[model samples]
Target: MSIKSKPTLQDVARMAGVSSMTVSRALTKPDIVSEQTRQKIDHAVRELGYVPNLAASQLVTRRSGIVGALITTITNPILATTIETLQQGLARAGFHMLIGETRFSQEEEGKLLRAFLGRQLDGLILAYGYHSPETLELLQAAEIPVIELWDLPEGEVPRQPVGQVVGFSNWAAGASAGRHLVACGYRKPAFFGYDDERENLRFQGFRRAVLDGLGVEPQRYKTSAIPSIEDGVDMIERLARGELDCDAAFFTNDMQAIGALFACQRLGIAVPQTLGICGFGDLPIARVAAPSLTSVRIPAEKVANSTVELLCQRIKGEEPWAANIDVGSELVARESTALRR
Candidate 1:
């Protein structure tokens, strides 16, 4: 049997009766080429089954048409929504996304940054605003638009960002959750969360709210466990067994809150009646839990949209009017924190 060779740009140009340069422009910068010429080039490309050499095209236009995104994990419901929306938005703009998991590790993030930079990504989206010194250096020298999502930089409005930021205040969200718990008459609240910068900000805000509302300090439990239902179950079991002391508890995310709810059911502890519960990142499950959980709802979709908009603008050599976008968060009062008896 004879072997068939893959079609090339020259084949398309020949079939379309146009120069190779014209075909190249039609493929990469269709707007610049006339509509009639573009149609001929498109038909010829289809007929010849010619796939443009992306690497060769990148050399000419200095654009990879690829964007790199780094997130803590792909499993978090809140971050999952953000990633999905971001991918869809980038697709609409003729770009593709390359996702990486940092697992909240600055070192892993720095390593991924080096690898992504080697690929010459046109832009980068980071879920966390904080970065290691080496990662920051890489970003500064990369000369590409970098947009931070999920958490805003701490500063004044219109504050200068590394490049751009599209997220809400983690501190404000935690404070909102704390205030809601207090409003529901939960005194001596307990916090079950991580001891990282973002979660620490939340804890600080929560502490401030608890102090101001009830004049009592919230008991803090630092956990290095992956935010999961089992961990939440263990924490709630401890509360039930008198191992921890608090009338109310706040978790870092909804999965843990749901877990706590499960434990409460098994241990015969009525939610909101005996112990109030609140969580951040109001996942869909929080709304339908046995006793619906009250939680801070981060604007994942809004952040994703804003990140794509600003990134696309920067990639096109346009300055976004707003470099810092604070979508803000809402604390939804649900059954879990309705009232204290």
Candidate 2:
């Protein structure tokens, strides 16, 4: 067969020295076919670049075998773990995932959702809970199993989730970091992060903790830019220049915290002594940084497993035992925040 020509099932079977029915059974129901014959069919398909007609398969099975995932950005190391795990889990269950970057915009998310819906995906997995009204309406109309990640409302019913929700409380994670800073004997802590709604919840929790523990409100420093190491470096530089007044700072994620640590070293500011630092999302670098970072650890794998399990259940026309699953977060104490009182 010419490599440029579209290969068919007969071509594959002819190359593999098997009948068309045997090749079909091997591809669709391999368990019933002998291992030796299945290997020949696979080798022939690979050589010919044969692509199965997913349209025909879907028409018969009523399943597209595809899931759509939307996230803020692929650059954030913190979210990378969850996405990798979700992809692996979905692939294990014979489902392929198509991912889109929303860049934290409702308009972009809605556009991606519409594109995915047109393909008739079996389900969708979203990074955060908040969505545009149009996006919500689309999900309602699609009526497929949807899983929202990263911001579960604690003890309160969510207005979204046409299906299941799996995530931790951002507010709680921030509060834990704030209390950790207080325990380290730092006063006048400040929040340094993005101005997104989810980031705002973390700031609110951190503020509540600082107010209760230190009897003073923490300062707020925010930017609309996505949180990055450069942002963290700039924040520390501002503090050194007296542009901000705070003894400690809680950042949005480990990237910022790691950046702050590097900046402190360059500026001669002693961490946990002259300035304390903490961050959310205990990315791998947090454990190995010079002073190490104090951060909140989100259960990425747990969330992934639960999300896949629930989504599969919904796909099977079964209701999940529970709609909301809060895997929760934990504060990891480390050298960066180990201030001596």
lDDT of 1 at 151: 72
Tens-digit lDDT track of model 2 for 1-341:
66777999999999999999999777655657898998899999999999988899889879888999999888888778889999988875668899999988899999999999999999999987888899999999998889888887643343555556898887888899888899889878888888876787888889889999999978999854566888889988988999999988898878888888999999999998899898888998999898989899998889988999899888878868787898989999999889666
Q: What is the Å distance of residue 168 in model 2 from its true position?
A: 0.5
Inter-residue clash pairs, candidate 2: none
Top candidate by TM-score: 2
**What lDDT does each candidate get?**
0.86, 0.86
Model 1, span 167-242: residue lDDT tens: 8887788888888888888777888898877787888888888889999889998765458888789998888778
Worst lDDT run of 10 residues, candidate 1, spans: 152-161
- TM-score, candidate 2, is 0.89
> Poorest 10 consecutive residues of model 2 by lDDT?
154-163
TM-score each candidate.
Answer: 0.88, 0.89
